[model samples]
Target: MKLAVVGGGSTYTPELIDGFARLRDELPLSEIALVDPDERRLGLLAGMATRMLARAGHPARVTTATRAEEGVEGAGAVLLQLRVGGQAARDVDETLPLECGCVGQETTGAGGLAKALRTVPLVLDIAETVRRLAPDAWIVDFTNPVGIVTKALLDAGHRAIGLCNVAIGFQRRFAAALGVAPERVSLGHVGLNHLTWERAVYLDGEDVLPGVLADHAEEIAADLSMPGWLLRRLGSVPSYYLRYFYLHDAVVEEQRTKPSRAAEVAAMESALLEMYGDPSVDTKPELLEKRGGAFYSEAAVALVASLVGDRGDVQVVNARNGGTLPFLDDDAVIEVPARVDARGATPLPVDPVEPLYRGLIAHVSAYESLALDAAIQGGEERVRDALLAHPLIGQAGPADELARRLVDANRSFLPWAVSR
Candidate 1:
């Protein structure tokens, strides 16, 4: 079977290619294709892939294409990991929300809405190309605003799977926190990407959270190095996006206090910009090599390995509600644990989420509906509703005024907007 990776020049490509090599025997990958718009970046990725395969002593043909159609042709599976706009645009996404008195984080709120607006059209174009070129291929999407982009592809009438490593990655972390092997822990997860909760976890057929959290309080506090520390302190497992959650309340509470040194925050922005800057710079190779060893890459490799190895029933956060969340549309992109097999993914049933989570789902659903409406009909009211219904907007609004300001501010990115 052939595998095609779109966004081939991505920083994550080498790790993904390395991952495929680990599973090449099981999947028997006859060919691999790398597609990217930037030839320089594509050349770098193509060269890296060649070296990786050489090191592994495997001789699979690796091809590069600047055209999306050519890259996806004859592929059995297409892995998408593109960023529609580059880091400069993402900087706008991150800062816009703060300007509007809301948390200016990417992947949720107004920032996510902006991202969805810019990304959906491009992603839809790619999906259409895949439909024409490889009608039977399963599109595995790893793009941000994943829920919205995935829904756009499905709404446009294509077969695709939204994949997020967050759900399973967190499950394993929480299981280890509770002193149980990941395979031995049974878990239930549900919500939107980066905003999910562990409803339950059982080890050796017994509930373990109460005892685990009570005993591990200090250790958990110490380990809040990644996102979701506050939630963990409040007796819930942290999602991959714990940092946003931590900052939400912090941003609100610190409104009176002079903003302290945001060194960590500044450092992160600098690092991301440097990472996404010129690929021809001398230090680029070392940077990419170091990134190849991150936890995100490791998680991606583990997921691909699980699918190819047919390693029993591993759970993943995939799209398709299919009763995992009856409160949301059956066809909506809800994140829940899914069973993977050689046939494909089957979403495991999760009980209805708690009222708070369900309420959050309602908020997300509004934005998703607006995104789809805009994509289909090019309407402004739907987009306005999306902005007003966002959690951050609610926290920072005279809804009508905030919506108007955001719509006006982001007119350039919107599908339909009144004259500025």
Candidate 2:
């Protein structure tokens, strides 16, 4: 099968390439088109991918294309992982919100909305081109703000599914704790992307989440940076991103002292790229682990196998609501477990949601809808409205201030941000 990775220049690509090599039997990758506009990083990543495949005796041919159209044409699946404004832009996204007394996060709050605004249009354009070049090809989005971007593609009538490593990360952690294989663990992972909760963890088809929580509350709470008492109260584990909301002021204060995550990632990427250019480095380096996106390759490979090879497996992915949550619009995209195959991902039924989580989901889903509107339609009014709806910026004064700051900081990337 032919696969195209839209952000093939990324340091994350090698992890993905390693999975392709190790799991060659699952999906017979014939040729891989590494797509990116940045030729330097693309050249380095392609060289490493070729080496990794060769060491595994996998006969997949690795190719490079600077344009999405050139790379994705005739491919069976195209994976979107591009960063619109790169890490420098991410620095702005990660830093500016703190000045407004909000969490400066790249995937939630004002920063996430900025990312969505910059990303949705670009992803929609690529989805449009893919529809023209390879209409049947599945668009697997591994981009940030996956919920919004996936919604954009789905709204435009493109076949797409959003992928995040959060569920897989939780599954792996739970599996280790249970002394079981990762496949044996299933998560009742529900909510929008980056904004999800682990309501249950099933092993041997029985809910083990309560025990895991009871036994590992401190460890889990430490990882989530949430107090153990809250986890106990909720009877669920929120994704780490929830830290921005549950502890908003503290998070803002913490963010003030640390270097922006973007800066740290930028340094890591420089080192990884240097390593990628070395001929002797045939295997993924240990330093890649520090670069984050844990278990990304495993998750991406499995999703690709299900989509291209028709495995019909249950996986956590972002797809249309389709009444999975009655409160959400049928067309709204949600992150949940779905049975995926060539036919497309079908969201499974969720158990009755508690009012606590449901209320937040509805609020954010509404913010996301407005965020999507501001992203696609583009206006100061839409931008302002989206910010007002965000749980992190519920007040008009702060919302208006953050909106102006967001537009000012991101003017170069957003056409409308600069147009006005």
Q: Using TM-score as the measure, which candidate wins?
A: 2
TM per candidate comes to 0.81, 0.98
lDDT of 1 at 117: 71
Candidate 2 overall lDDT versus native: 0.92
Tens digits of per-residue lDDT for model 2, 219-325 = 99998889999899889999999888888888888999999999999999999999999999999999999988889888988998898878888999999999999
What overall lDDT goes with each candidate model? Answer: 0.67, 0.92
lDDT of 1 by residue, 1-420 (tens): 677888887767766766667656555677789999989778777776777777677678889999898899988778888866665556666665665566665577766776777778878888889889998777878888888888887777777767776665656666778776776876666787767766566787676766766676456545554433454554566564544555676654453244322333344434533544534332234444433223444445444545555665656645677666777777778777677754556787676567866877767776677766654555555666777766667632544554565566556656566454
| Top-lDDT candidate index | 2
In terms of TM-score, how similar is model 2 to the real structure?
0.98
